[model samples]
Target: MTTAFITHHDCGLHNMGPEHPESPIRLLAIQKVLQKTGLIEQLKQMESVHVTPEQIQLAHANLHQKRLEMKQPDEGVVYADEDTALCPDSLHAASLAAGSSILATNQVLSDKVDNAFCAVRPPGHHAEHNAAMGFCFYNNVAIGAMHALQQPNVNRVAVVDFDVHHCNGTVDIFKDKPEVLVCSTFQHPYYPERYCDIQRDNIVNCPIEAHTRASVFREQLEKYWLPAIQNHKPDIIFISAGFDAHHEDPMADLNLTEEDYRWATQLLMDAARTTCGGRIVSVLEGGYNPVSLAFSVQAHLEVMAGY
Candidate 1:
């Protein structure tokens, strides 16, 4: 019945800007909500484990890593994109974000905890294998998913991404690979775009329009994501747990509410219960609009912890 929450203070320092939607406030909102609602007593908070270059190389190319390493600004802000920036501490924060997922994976796999959630920032779903954009430097959850799949004993792994923006990075890395099943639903015609043209049996990219509501989301979950996970029967389940799809988020037009997050997490949890002894490693990806993000994460974690 134990659940782990992985995070790092360094992740709080990677600021995109005051006006940027992906500001570091995303983490503060979640942490404050967990405290105010007394959810901290129900979950164990663990320090993020710093992932190495080799670990990040599992999901991203060495070239991508090298470019990010070289681009680290010594003082002022440098641009990864118009929206993404690197300040002096950006690399450290990004490293912690990626490492949080690795720690979450190891915690669940080693039986140190039953399930884990990473509440770090610099959301990573939009970064592709070699392209870092949409406020992501490295595909954190993808790195963790690859780590879990690369385990010498593991045979199958499934990744579920429910972000407002499609996880182009994750899809690009795992597409055409039989060992992994990546199911994602997002608001299309959005940032970084979807990887649908790269058609692969293992990837289920269900792009919903902006303001797509809860009932449609639930129906898609029942008809698409849940079935795919069941059929794949992954030895481990990895979630790119993003909340920007919430109705309150301004980043995208998705109208999903906290209840949607609750329902989705429950479905994933049920599938994990049936297939992997409830083994799920969820890492934070996207969620802005502080209030909505906080509420959505609360709902998601409540189900993951079986509350």
Candidate 2:
């Protein structure tokens, strides 16, 4: 149950817009839930560092990196796409968001903690290696997975995503890299729809139709993700922990509850314990409904904390 809690205030400063579903309140809600549930006191809290450009290059192209920097607005917000934008401190916040993953990875792999949950923002998993969209600037989990691969005794790593939208960015980065396995479950015919059907051996995509319930989500994980992860035998596990699929969330049409998230975390913990020494780095991706997001995160972290 030794888990590190990594986050930063800058993550909250990456404001897209007041009406944006991926607002800073998402992080605030998660924090409130942790505090209210007394889970904050039970774990080690660490400030997230800024991710280096070189580390970011592991998953994103140099041009894309520089473009984000160049797009940083000095005053008002500037749009990366219709859905994503950069305010005055957006790049800094995004950097911290990406860095949270790196910090969590090092902590878990070094055994400083058995696992980590990074409650940061600017949800990644949608931004491609050369593009920034879907309220994502950098592929945070992908960068962390590449960082883990650089460490000695760390080769195979797995990135598991349960966001309502497909993690096209993560799969794009690791599709050809056999050492990194990307397993994602998302609602199909959804946002950033490309790459859901990409032909790759290392990428396992379980596209759940809209209105699917928790039972189906669980079944897919057991049938598709379990066998793939077991075969990959990852040295560490990274999760793009997005809860936008909740029935209460407006972002997608999946009928998952907080308990479903808890069950998924339990399954991953069991798999990690048997295969990767319980090394897991979970980075926040998407969850719009503040109340449900908070409760969902609470349930997820309880399992990560071995409660």
Candidate 3:
């Protein structure tokens, strides 16, 4: 079967603001590039379902759900933090984004698809167990990881994040759970600088300095993520695929390229193939530059689609 491409229009309606880096245009750019590259039509496209409160509660505290609901604005934007915000439709959009992952997970686990990609967002890797921050409200990948574990024979899941900024929230959520292995790489001393120093066998964090290039990134992945993943041999693999580290991206100093995205996707795909029948679910996290984000996502998805 073909790879599943899961997304929703609601994701485009959750606008932070005109000036925000996590703009609605990010999704549009990805869609346009996928079409331009002829990759969109090669996959199995599906609309995202609205994520129920119960589904979110699997990864977050009840208080976090209530707070997000209470903070929803009817017209204008309400700030969850200096970086995070909610407009009238933000919650619905966020729900669909989270749901996209769950649906993609089901598709992959059920053998309906070779793998899956969730092209929805309000990127979720930074939202902690009970708090929303870092332009993320619900931890989508975390939710999907927990949801995947509910399946029979799925006792272990691996969450691999490459977002240029640490997935502090993912680490926070899964730190105590040995069943979930989180391998993340990000720039050190950067935004949301917490949990990077935590000592945990299941949580592997690689912190690179600014201006780090693809060669160093590849070396670090080999040194850190590969060994951890091989040992874990998770039942499935989830990727917090962020492209902000692209050399052309304005968000960070790490200099990666489209080829790097493809390389990482292939690397993880190989790991998935060996460990979990090639069941991989990748969720969008961060990639601000529209042009570069488009090309980078295209590169990532091409590999997921078996290019």
Candidate 4:
């Protein structure tokens, strides 16, 4: 199996503050770990390209990109929402973040790579179709899924999010579109609580309580997500891979170790082997603690790299 690692140096430029959990150090940590373990040399590393405005509109409102451009501060950071902020280089990095997903989709669909992992900042699962929040802007995975749907021989797609928080933005964009199947396992009564309870055949939401154990998380996915993916029979699979659910993470309460991440990645990989010919494009979402996040990502990539 061949895996592609897609990232951009500029993704580190969108710094909110030194105290902010979503600092550039997150990417630096992942890179450092990958290099230390010799995993970086095993994958096809590529720089991310900028996404066009037309592609950004695939999952966003027509004015969404323009509004963000308009709000960009010249000299200092400006808050788009209570949690999301924008500095001079924020949009530039965001454009690359969104673009990395598009490039990964293309690489996977073209059979150039069996799967791809996008390491990007300003994670996008919380960014709604009309708003940006939760340290996210421009719903990156959504843009990639939309792009994949437009490609030849691609009839349907599935998005699996294992983040501690629900993928409100991804659900918001594809809730009405039956061709896209979204399955998520998140902590109940969490942040950005929108579309969490909306009933849709395409959206399968498994809301686990805080402090949920890894075994229970696996059980929930096997019961809720596995069946959905089998029924959907997607042409491609996209993962909103978030490591914030790790037990060591300061962001949320979940007792998942790197081994759990490895187990989940293998579960999805097994599903992909049968359903989509092992085509998966995973985008980075929320993982705050640099040490735990790096190790967790290493586990996920190890499986993708055929270890």
What residue runs in model 1 are displaced by over 4 Å at the alpha carbon?
none
Return the lDDT, model 2, position 184: 94
**Pairs in steric clash, model 1:** 211-253
Whose TM-score is higher: candidate 2's or candidate 4's?
A: 4
The candidate scoring highest on lDDT is 4
Candidate 1 residue 188 Cα shift, in angstroms, is 2.0
Q: Give lDDT: candidate 2, residue 4.
A: 92
lDDT of 1 by residue, 199-227 (tens): 88899888888766668888888999888
lDDT of 1 at 160: 93
Off by over 4 Å in 3: none
Model 4 Cα shift for residue 163 (angstroms) = 0.9
lDDT of 3 by residue, 15-52 (tens): 87899999999999999888987899999999999888
| Tens digit per residue, CA lDDT, model 4, 1-307 | 8999999999999999888899999999999999999999999999999999999999999999999999999978999998899999999999999999999999999999999999998799998898998999899999999999999999999999999999999999999999999999898888878889999999999888888777999998899999999999999999999999999999888889999999999999999999999999999999999999999999999999899
Top candidate, metric TM-score: 4
- Please give each candidate's TM-score: 0.97, 0.99, 0.99, 0.99
